[model samples]
Target: MKRRLEPGRLVIASHNKGKIPEIAALLGPYGMDIVSAGELDVPEPEETGTSFAANAELKARFSADLTGLPALADDSGLCVEALDGDPGIFSARWAGSGKDFGRAMELVERNLAAKGPEAGRDAHFVCALSLCWPDGHIVTVEGRVDGHLVWPPRGDKGFGYDPVFQPWHHDITFGEMDPDRKHAMSHRADAFRKLVAAVF
Candidate 1:
């Protein structure tokens, strides 16, 4: 039997502003209070797990234990099929030196140079969400968005690898889409939709 999800004020176990607001907005309709870990100044656990699900649970369980409240954590990133999922977990660090994505994208372009775009230059964004209760029980869900890659990032909306990832449904990249449009189709949105239906 599956455990029930208890609802109340919960902590979003992450410091990324890009992720925080979208999650909060999604949770608002559920009548659940959403608080960020940064707001509470809680220390994040090291994400040593090799998989997205493992990493999300590590952080969520840690935050739930710390805040004594149900907590939600998400591990997300872009995965290039040609790169053999090269920046899967290291997507954040890929942008070395002051979180400069321009440099990061440059690295990806360089890495793919030998492979050539036609040789399976496809990519996708993956998101894993974990919700942990104060009682030590946890539940997890995952979402992914597949699409081919486009070089030389585009637009100014959204953050992270948004500029380079263009979902299968649209010709424009995520960064070029409107905020509401991106939020509706993103992997994060897909995961949160399941979370809302299952928990909130």
Candidate 2:
């Protein structure tokens, strides 16, 4: 079957370096010539959505319209059950004035400090991917990984909330794990798997 996305120079509606590789890896199998919004100086739209799916669609649709090409966007964050599922949409802002995951991790630990150990500090990382075409058709997919947060952080590989997020059945954080392993269990992988299936 011919892939709906096809093979072409497409745009990723995000400026984050961390997201590009994942998106590229996911779409590469289908033979896509992926491009990033940053490469074209496309602006990132403010994510005003209350959920990951909404935000992904917002970015993807906006970029697709702006570039007149299919666009892929992802919105992902860590949700800690102990914090009332907090740091959900605010995961990026947990660090306060900047995009500092270190500060973000600190804030999470502080928030859970008073709750004490095993205070349902359980967390899961969620990723939502949106694919939009210039013709106004859009498809979205979501994926999640059950995990927990560890204090003081660990490893130095992955970014954002990676160092602190320990996946189920793993003693090390996502940052500490191999990229292949991380990608296998990652929320982005799950969503992208669904997305590729839909597109193809």
Candidate 3:
């Protein structure tokens, strides 16, 4: 049987400025008193896990254990097929210590250019979410949205590699879409839906 989350305080176990708000927005409808690990001054744990789900659980478990509150963490990234998932788990690392996504995006474009015209632009975003309780019980779910990469990027909204990705069947890139539209079909939202069904 799956565990259910009672209406109460919950910690969002992430330090990324871009991610915390997106997550908080997703959890807003649930009526839990949402607070972030950053807000609580909880230090980020090393994400040594090999996959998104593992990393998410690692963060969630760390925060939940420390704060004695239910914690939610998300590990997500962009995987490019042409690059054989070059930056998959290292998506954040690709941005370096400064979190310079402009440089990271340039690296991706440069690498793709190295592959020549024949190399496909096929790509997708993956999000894995983990919810952990103080006693160690945890639940995890993953979601993905297929898309292709675009040059010069687009839009000023959204964060990370959103500017360069155009989901299949969408005319505009994720960065160009309205937040509500993006939220409706995002990889994170996909995972959140599953999470709500399982734990709410």
Best by TM-score: 3
Q: What's the TM-score of every candidate structure?
A: 0.94, 0.95, 0.98
Q: What would the per-residue lDDT of candidate 3 be over residues 1-200, giving only the tens digit for each residue?
A: 77899999999998888887788788889888989999999999999999999999999999999999999999999999999997898999999999999999999999999999999999999999999999999999999999999999899989999999999999999999999899889999999999999899
Candidate 2 lDDT tens digits, 14-81: 98888798778767678788889999889989889989999999999999999999998999999999
lDDT of 1 by residue, 1-200 (tens): 56656557989999888889888876776777889999999987888999999999999999999999999999998899889997898998899748888888888888999886476778999999999999988889998888977888998898888898899979999989998888888899899888776765
Q: What's the lDDT for all of these models?
A: 0.87, 0.87, 0.94
Model 1 vs truth, CA RMSD? 1.5
Candidate 2 backbone overlaps, count:
0
Which stretches in model 3 have alpha-carbon errors above 4 Å? none
| Model with the higher lDDT, candidate 2 or 3 | 3
Alpha carbon lDDT at 58, candidate 1 = 98
Per-candidate count of clashing residue pairs (backbone under 3 Å): 0, 0, 0
Give the clashing residue pairs of candidate 3, or none. Answer: none
Error of 2 at 51 (Å): 0.8
User: Stretches of candidate 2 above 4 Å error?
Assistant: 1-3
